[model samples]
Each structure stands twice: as C-alpha cells, then as structure tokens.
Target: MAHDLTTPRDGIPPVLSTPASFREAAAALASGQGPLAIDTERASGFRYDDRAFLVQIRRRDVGTFLLDPEGHRTEFTAALAPVLNGQDWILHAAPSDLPSLAWLGLYPGSLFDTELGGRLAGLDHVNLAAMTELLLDVRLAKGHGAEDWSQRPLPANWLAYAALDVELLLELGDTMAEILDNQGKLDWASEEFEYIRNTHSTITGPAEATWRSVRGVASLTRPEQLAVARELWMIRESIAVEEDRAVSRILPNKVLIEIARLLPRTARELVRVKGFRRSEVRFWGEIIQRALESDPRTWPTRDRPPRGLPSRQTWAAEHPDSWERFSNARTLLDDLSADLAIPVENILKPAVLRTVAWGATVGREIRSPLDLPDVLRDYQARNWQVELTAPILTETLFR
Candidate 1:
C-alpha cells in the first residue's frame, strides 16, 4: 500500500536563519554520518534571479536542517563547507539546484543525482514524486513548487513540503543504484552524475538577440519591426532586473510581439494593443514609446551570429550526401538506444552527431570511424560516450 508522507520522518526543524543557528546546524551536519541528502527551492517564476531562497539537507545522524541562504549568506557557506566538501551529496535533480547552491559558494566534491540514475536505469518517470512512490512507496505532496520562496516567514505547510523533499532522497538513491548495478549500467550512471557535478550551467552567458527567441519575432519581416522587438525586449529586461520581477510578469512575449508588429508610436497607441492594456503597461508605457520612437537608423541592422551550430533541418538541402550519412548514423543510434534501453539523446547528442557527419564529408580528413574519437574530442564528447557510440558511428559513417 502507498503511504502519504504527511510530515518529515523526524519532524521539521526550525529554519536556521541566524549566524549562530547556521553554525550549529553546520557543526551537526559536519559530524553527521553517511551521505548528505540535499535539495534547494528557488523563486524562479516570481523573481528575476534564480537564487536559492531555501536549502534543505538531511543526514542519518544529524536529522534535517533547513537553511535560509537569503539572509545568512556569509555564515551559511562557511559553516556548511566542512560537511559538504568531499561528501557524496545525493539530490533528485542536481542540475536545478547546483547552480544556485554554487552561487552561495557551496559545492559538492561528489554527487549522486537520482534523476540521472533513474534515466540510466531506464525508468520512464524520473521525477521525485514518481520515483519516491515507485521505489519508496511514499506519496509526496504537490502544488508547492511554484510558491514564492522569496516571501518571509514561510508557512508551516510550505516548510513541511520543503523538508519532505530530501526525506527519502537517500533511500531513492540506494534503490536506483541497486537497479543500475543489476542492469550493468552503474558505471554509466556514475559517469553521468560526475558530468552533472562538473558541467557548467547552460544559462551562464547573456544570450545574443534574445528577442529572436520570442515566439512571433520570425513573423515580423521588416527591419524596423525587428528593431522595435529588440528595443522592447531590452527595456523589459532592464525593468525586470531593477524591480527583481520576472519578465513575463512585467509583460508577456505575446504582448511584446504585438507591440513590435503594430509599431505603436504613443502611450495611447501602445495601450490599444490587445495585451498591453494591463496596469503594468500603464507604468511602462513611456519606456515602450521611447524604444519605438528611436530613429530607424539607430535600430539594429543585423543579429549576431548564433552561438551554437545551425539547425539540422537545413542540412539536407545544403549537403545531400552528408545528410544521407547522418541519417544512417541516426538509424544506428536508434537501434543502439533500443537495445540498451537508453534514450537516444543520452547515447549521443544530435548536435555532436551532425557536426561529425558534416565534418566527415566537408573539409576534413576523417577516413574511418576510428578517426571519430578525434572528431568527438573536438566536440567535447566524454570518453565513456565516445567508447559506447564510436564503434557504431564508425561502421555507419565509414560504410
């Protein structure tokens, strides 16, 4: 029978807020036995920045400690460093929490990502709630994930929800590890967890022409409208950063795209746009007008070159022979994924595969699949990934 986890197995402790409290919690954790079960909650949709508002950790000996990093930032890291360093931190989705935790100067020397472990073990649903119920037979409460963690004095229920997140993480990790070992993919899971721990967050840099990512920007054919979209996007971003509000809360993409398309010249005209009649637009109307009224020459003439490779959809038309080879490689990858019960993307990223396929035919001396390691290395594929897929790619591409 599935059991509903109404509260922490060892009751929720008061949040450690002050320097003294943090130090005490840290000391307890440092002396605690076994790996630390770690998790973090962030106000992603409610705030502009993705900083952790609350961090929850658990250990067998130390019990559960909820640390509020927002106020005790300085003491939090110093106190927790001794415990977190060189410890196997077990987390459900490490990537989501790692960046925010790293921002506060806390990093794990090693980690066991249960989500990745589930993937390598070929479990269809790897979410915490699903995994917990499946492996540990406990139902986690839902509907608290999007709560505004930036708010002060978190409610009792919210605190309970937060503490419960790390409650079964250790158990889940152990069960998933056993499954992966039985499947003979424990090594693969270890490689994946290490990769997650060391890999950089994808959101580090300022994206170029971020306006282009808006939904309807492609429909705006005129340079003037594109310029308007860029200006409006920048203005919205500035407001979001200054007010610490999410850009979507300030103005939705649909509204911004509508303003760009209409090229509204005045506050009145801007308000006339379908989605711009909200109170937020009333406050930001002048800023939008200023962006639209700037001289056309002042608008951006062209977008910067995209940071990564171009879309693969164009490859067939641009290079038919290379496209054929890529298709063959993709087929082989599909077969491999099916045989191993792993996702195709996990076996090899499509972008890396495309680069190799295109390079094999154009301006490169890749004679056989054996030369794929050099190509894969240039593309930053790990040794384990190359070992698994290189042989198949060699046969498919070379023949």
Candidate 2:
C-alpha cells in the first residue's frame, strides 16, 4: 500500500522573493549537481495573466527553492535564468509550465518530461500523483491545485504543497529515465521532448475574443444567445482584469450561459435564474439589459465561427472516399501503435493524421513520390515520428 506523501523531506523551504535572495538561490542551484526538477504555480482560472507567480526547483545537493517570480522580476531574470538555462530539466507536463517560464525569459537546454516518459513507457495513468504511486509507492494528497496563487504571503500548508511538487520530481525523473532506457525508448522520448521544447510559444497571456472558449457557448445556436454570451463574457473579462480576480468569480460560464438563454428583462428575473447570484444581478442588471436590447448588428455577426477539418464522424456520409482512406490509415496506425507499445496520438498527432489522410485521398500534389516525409514535416511531425510512420503512410495513403 502506498503511504501519503505530505511533508517535504527537508521540510518546507522558505520562499525566495528578493533580489538578494534570488541571487543566493541561483548560487545554491548552480552548486548543486545533476538535472534540475522544476514546477511552477500559476493562477490560470483565477487571474487574467496566466503568469507563473511561484516557481519550484530542486536538485540533489541543494534543497528546494520556491521563488516568487513576480516579486523580483529583473533580479530573477538575471540571476536564475543563467543558472536555469543550459541545464537539463525534468518537468511534468512541461507544455503547461514551459510557456509560463519562458514568459520570464527562462528556457531549458534539454528536457525530460516525466509525464511524457510515462506515456512512452505505456503507463496506464501518467499524472504526477499516479506515477508517484506506481513508481515510488507514495500517494500525494490533493488540495491547493486550484488556489489563487496570486495571493501574497502564501500559507504554510500551501507552501508545503508547492514544495512537495519538486521534492520527489528528481527521483521520479531518474526512475522514469531508467524505465525508458530498459524499454529502448529513451531516444524516442528525447525527440518528443525536444519537439515540445522548440514548439511551445512564450506568449502566456489570455487570447483576445476569449468568449468563444466559455463552456456551453458553442451549444447556443441562436443569434440572441450568442450576443448575450459575448456581452457577459466582455463584462466578466473587464471586471476580472481590472480587479485582478478570476472571471468565474465575476460570472461563471454556466451562469453567463443561463442569462444568455433566458435574456432576463429585469434584475428580479435575472436573480431568479439558477446559479446566478442576486448580488451580481443588482450590479450588472443594466449591463445585461443593454446587451439584450443592443442593435442586432452589434451582436456577434456569426452564430459560430468557421472551423477547419470537418468532424470525422461526418466524413462517412459527406466524403466517403476520404473516410475510407482515413479509416484504412487509422487501422494501420493502430497496429503500429500496438506493436510499438506507443499511444496512437504519440505515434502521430491525430490532427496531422486526419489532414494527411484527407490530403492523400484528394491526390494533394507533391513534389515527388517520396514526398511523404516532407508532408509529415509540414504538419509538425518530428524526425523520429516520420521515420516510424512515413513509410507506412506512404504505402497506405499516397499509393
């Protein structure tokens, strides 16, 4: 039975927020040996800026360091970025964390993503907690994952949770590497890690016209509903940005959708809608009415934005030949996945496969008969992936 992993073996380290402290932290880290195990805490749903407020790093000789990136921005960039870059890093779900770190000018020299390693090793569950239990026999307690990391003077328990993130990460990375080596997949994992490191963008801020991402917004097909949802989203965005609070705290997507659907005419009516609080109705009642009464021209002109790659389910009826080609290629991929013990998505990204299948069926022009490799590269398939799948795709798709 796996026991709960609660406290850090070294106890919770104090947060380093000052330039002087950051310099010391960098010095300490530089002296430590081996790859660094790192994690970052972000207020994704709680703040408009998805920046890493807190960064956790650990090494063998040096103890863990919890850094406040927001406190000493210039100092942090100058001090830690030098020590951090040009070193092998072990991260979990690096795609999520890399962008945030990169926003602060921190980049990894090379990476070993434990989560991706577990996936390559064909583990049933690859999350940090799951891998810990399976590989290290320790159960990590769950809490504070959704906390507002922007809050200053983080509580001790939250600090402990943060510390625990990196406490075992180095050990986990080592074990995961061993597993990959034994399975003859360390090279494959390396290629995937490099692809992720190179491809992830440093832009970490929320996107413009963000309302389209709200839950259930796509389900509302009516023009009026889309308009109301957009209005609510705009108001929520403004409030969240100005106040530095999560948009959901201002108005949850479900409540926004509810008000959009009902188009309530009065504060009394808006308050009655389930999930919408009366206090919110009193404050935004006028804004809601204006949205409903606004000129139809001002409303979102499109009911739903245009999307690429028609749904795969519709292909059988609308594009039978493409569907047949996709199905045949997908079957070959599945067999390859089983033989290689790699997930199909890991073998080739699903979107790339779909695009390739469709393009091949339509006789999309190519420079040469051996143009499959070039096409795969265009779709962001790495060299290792191309080596494994291009021949099979050429035989099944191009021919």
Candidate 3:
C-alpha cells in the first residue's frame, strides 16, 4: 500500500538528502503560508533532550516538509526567519516543541494553540488525535508510538505516523476557533495563545544555571549551596551540550540538589546521594569534587541566587488572597484541562503563577486571568506577552 504524505510538501517533498534540497525547502517555507503546523521527533527515550532528529513543518496550502537537522547543514536562518518574522502558527502542544527548536536556532511566532483554545471554549479532549477525531472524523492511527525518528530512511510506518500527526491540525484549529468565538472566549484564548508564541528560550548559557532553582536548597548556607550549585550547573550544562540533550537527561534537579547539599568531596561520598549511580559518579565524580571543594566565599556573588524557600507561614502572611486564588485557579485549571484532555499544568504552570502573584503584589498591578506569568513591565515592553496581569490581580487579589 502506497502511503501519501500530509501534503505535496512544496511539490518536492523535502528528501533532506543534501544541503541543496534543504536550502530549497527553506526558501519554499518562506514563500508559503502565513501559518504552519509543526511537530518534531527525537530519540528522547535513548537520549537526553527532544531535538529535531526530525523536524516536520506543514504550511497551510503549501505542504509538510521534514528537515534533517543532523545530516542537512542548510542554515535555517532564511527559511525559518520569514515564517517566524510576522506570521501566526497553529500548534497543539507548541510550548514543549518551541523551546527545543530555539536550541537548534528556530523560534516560531504568533501561535494559535488548539489545545488551549479547546480549554478556553470548554470543549472536551484537545489531544491532536482526539480533537481531529471529534472535529474532522479522522481516526489517525497511533502505531508509531515508539518509533525511532533518528534513523535515516524513516520507515513507512513512521512516515504515516508523522503525516497523520499534522494532517488534521489546521482543520482542528479552525474548529476550535469557531467554538471559542461562539463562547465569547476567543479573545481570552487568543491572548493566551499570543503569549505562548512569544515565549523565549529559558536556557541561555552554561554560565547561567538552573540547578539552584530547586526548592529546599535555601536551607543550606547560601555560600556553600551557591558554590556547589554553580559547579553542578556548569557540569550539567557541559554534559547536556556535549550529549545534545536536556540537562535533566544528565540528571534531574532533585539528584543535582542532593549532590550539591551533600557536597560529595570524593567518589566514595558520591554514593551517599540517592540518585548518583556509580557510573554517573565514575563519569563526573572528579568534576563534582572540585566544585564542592571550591571556597563558596570566594565564588562571585553577583549572580549567586539566594538559597532558600519561604515558610508556609510567611507565604500565607505575605499574600492572604493568594492561597484562595491559587486554589480556585487550580480547580478551574484542572476542570478545563480535563475537559480539553490536556494536562492541567500545561495550561497554567504553578511556577508561572508564583511569579505572577509576586510580580503583581510587588509591582502593585492588577491583571486578568489570575493564573499566568506576571505581566512584567520590561517583559511587556519587549516581547509579545499579553498584559494579562492587571485583570488577574484584580480578580484574584482585590476581589
């Protein structure tokens, strides 16, 4: 049985056999539609981060093309820049995909997330397959559940899986839009979707660290934790970059924090940390030791984050309304998320909510939709984020 691709793929289905084909495809992408449907597949089970072992972009009215980031060296600057320059993109779960794309030098713009739309519109089940089935009556098969996308000459099964991955996205987004419009929730979802498209990559460089971002580290002495954190952070950064994977692939934050607090001074000390398996220590033990031994006092304090967590009592005292608002927001988020068949956390992350709460109270602003990231002034001036803080703050705090 001959399989058909999602679309004609610019009349030449990007083979990605060489640089020339890639360049041609990139040019085609720029000249194509204003919005595109995109998905990526990587060897995540075997590797650390989700990278474009295979990048699939389907431009409405144009076609879907698969880019081989590994084999093709065609600069994505020209091809991807135009699409992202001032265009809207439709994606189901774009938040997860876009970050990794940024690492590979592609950042999308003006997103319309159907999953988000479904939630705002009070619909049920927003996963691509479910949404497509409900909206378009297309029962996309899910056979390629664990296919390895890194392998060249992608298998027929995988290609079908990939094609079906985006075949109904454009239609599904349109259906979700109609539903949103009917419910008077279009503006709300549109605001949130715009926020999603404009999201920037959180991972900046090796020098800037995230291991210390873990909770409970504040219990440790600031200097000691900072020194160990910097060391572990740098180690993780190097490992991630070298392995071309996410830092968590090297080790999760819990393990990293545990190691930092323990300040494992030697290979033998490494064993005390729960997740620090012997092989991991064998690979990174020396480096860890050097970091633990470094004088925390001498380490630069300019960017050393304060190591601590706020007591529940202190948090409650600081923002009496927050707990209620957070609780209300969580229930709303959970209900809507379950209705849309997406994870609740996907719609409103608690970390983002924390930042929103603090920013509003400290900055003295009111924002809408009480449970998103803070509408920072500087962030607002620069990026495309919606100034949603004002209304959210008012409803959640003042009201």
Candidate 4:
C-alpha cells in the first residue's frame, strides 16, 4: 500500500519542476476536493527567525510533495505568487512559518491551522504526530536532525523525511474535522483558522519592537515598560542588524524583562539582575544603563496593577463561595477539554481563567471568547463590584 501510495524509491521526483510540472500537480491537487495539510521545517538555529527552509504540502487525495525553496532556481517570489495570493493553506501553529512564507512574497489568502483547530475541538495533545496517532492510529517517525539544508547534495533520507511531514496532513485534517464535527466545535475551529488567515502581515526589520512580542508585559507600569522596551529594542535592533544575528541571541527576553523590572540606573546596578549573561551584559550594558539614566522623572514610579495587586486571598475571605465556584469552573473546563479531546490551555488560558473567577465572584458573566479586551472587560466589571462591596464584605462577611 505504501509503495503504491508514494512515489517510488527511485525516480525523478514530481515536486517543483518546470512551470508545466507545477501546473499539472497544482491542477491535480486543486481537484482533490480536500483541504491541504501543510508543515514547514526551517534552519531556525542557523536563521535569525522561524522560517520554512523546506515546505511540505500534502493533499489527502494526491499525496505529499516537498518544495526546496533554496533549490530549483525557482523564483518563489514569482512562481508561488498566485498560491499565496489565493489558496487557504492548512498549517499547524501558523506563526512560525509566517515570516518565511511572507518572505517568499506569497501571502496565504486563508489558513486552516490544524493545531489551533484541535485546541478549539478540545484535544489535549495537539502535536502533529500525537494527533496522527489518535486520529489515524499511525505513528509518524521523528525527522529532526542537524543536517543543514543550505549544503549541496541534500540526502535522499532528508528529502523523504521532509515529504513525510505533509503526506498525512490532509487525512489528519479530515479525521480531526470528523472529531470536531462530532464534538460540535467545528465553528470554533473555523473561527481560529479564519482568524489566522485574515491576520495582517508580520512586521520585520528595525521598525519592529520586541515589546509587542513580550509576554506578561502588562504586569509592568505602562510608561516604564514602554520606555525600557523602546530603549532595549533600539539597542537590540542596532546590534542585531550590525551582527546579522537574532535579537534573542544577543539578549533573551527574560534578561530584557529583568532589566526593565530592576530599572537599573547604572552599570553596577544592572549587573545584579538575575540571569544577566556576562557576555550580553558586557555587550549592551552601557546601552541599557544609558536608557535607565536618561530620566528618573520620566520613568514610571507608579505601582503596576496585578503585579502585587490585592491578593485573591482577600477576595476569598470576603466571598467564601468564590473560591469554590472558581475551582468548580476550572475543574469543569479541564474535564471538558479532556473528554472533548482538546487542550485545557486552548479552551481558557490561565489569565482568562483568573478573570472568570474574579468576575463570577462579583456576579459577572464570562461571555466573551478569550481575547485581551474581553479579559479587560472582565477585570473592570469584577473590580467595580468588588470595590463597592469591599468594606461591607470585609467587615460583616469576614466577622
């Protein structure tokens, strides 16, 4: 069955070739009446950003193919312009491949991210291989290696490994779709996929700020975070562009956040921050110190909300039922995810869960899907009610 299904072990492969080959394969693929399953593996270690050095695409009906962007002398900018322009590419965790694909001057018209789809469907383990095992009862061989794709004479084994990635995507998607449909979560999957496809292009180059990508950023005072982040980004940008290296390589986000948190005003103070790699400190310490020293007045002195905000313990004391309610809701969601075959984190993130707990405590509803504005709304509603009743609840309810 494998022999018949796959291109023979010996033969000129039918991947990207002349325009005629591309036309024929694309025509067959288009007629297959199934969404394509797509995956990308890139030399992330070698490159500054996550990109698809090799693209693997599979149509359930037509089999899988590997496209060597570095090979074929194929001007992808022109050759793949149309596919990027129109087709809805099914991807797993689409962001990793966005930079590289966007680099190819091919913007995917839409996307069907199976990983996100699985999450919305409520699957715990969304890794491609694991999903394949659960849905198809087939185990995929692990294919990662240190072999550099930029090298000449790419091994046949490597090619096969690459091709195998996409080969089962369409089938996997179909299986996942069946599960989603049965679970009545197909709309959720569609929402996630369409959200990915309709998103704006990723920002690259010096203008891009690392702060936008930083997690837990809102924990810091907005002005302090904003100024420190601006300075850190400028310094990182200058060095990254000059050295042609990744920003994280020079100074990881952890160190950057630590620096901001400490608000180091001098070289001496800067050295005390945790995990401040000496090499990085030596390289960019002065730049950071200078930013810190620039304006004591301008730097945010106000305490950030939620960092050391009033404890959940306070809330728990006032409304004893709140904790129980939150626990019940969380347990309910976790069990629901497991039963429904989705990841718990996908249904409601920890931050979102926090908002829900706080909201319900003060008599608020969690109606919005997981989003920043929705979370903010939850926080606002809960705080207003909690604050209003705080004195009474603390005195009468606690006593």
- Candidate 2 lDDT score relative to the true structure: 0.85
Write down the TM-score of every candidate: 0.89, 0.88, 0.68, 0.64
All candidates: CA RMSD in angstroms? 3.1, 2.8, 6.4, 8.1
- In order, what lDDT does every prediction score? 0.81, 0.85, 0.63, 0.60
Candidate 3, residue 338: CA error in Å?
A: 13
Candidate 1 lDDT over 175-253, as tens digits, reads 9889999999888888888877777334333334377888888778777788878877888888888998988887888
Model 3 poorest ten-residue lDDT run = 381-390
97-216 in candidate 2: lDDT tens per residue? 988888787888899999999999999899898999999999886588889898888998999999998888998999999999999999999999998887764453434658887888
If ranked by TM-score, best first, what sequence of candidates would result?
1, 2, 3, 4
- Which stretches of model 3 miss by more than 4 angstroms? 1-17, 26-34, 42-51, 60-62, 71-74, 80-85, 100-109, 143-153, 200-219, 222-226, 243-246, 249-251, 264-269, 280-285, 288-399
Clash totals for all models, in order?
Answer: 0, 0, 12, 6
Tens-digit lDDT track for model 3 on 206-320? 2234654656555556566667767777777787778766666677777877876777777788887887778877766776767657765676342446643355477678766
Candidate 4: stretches off by over 4 Å: 1-33, 43-46, 60-63, 68-77, 95-112, 116-124, 134-137, 143-157, 182-188, 199-207, 211-233, 256-282, 285-310, 331-345, 348-350, 360-399
lDDT of 3: 0.63
Weakest 10 consecutive residues, lDDT, candidate 1?
Answer: 200-209
Query: What does the lDDT read for residue 111 in candidate 3?
Result: 78
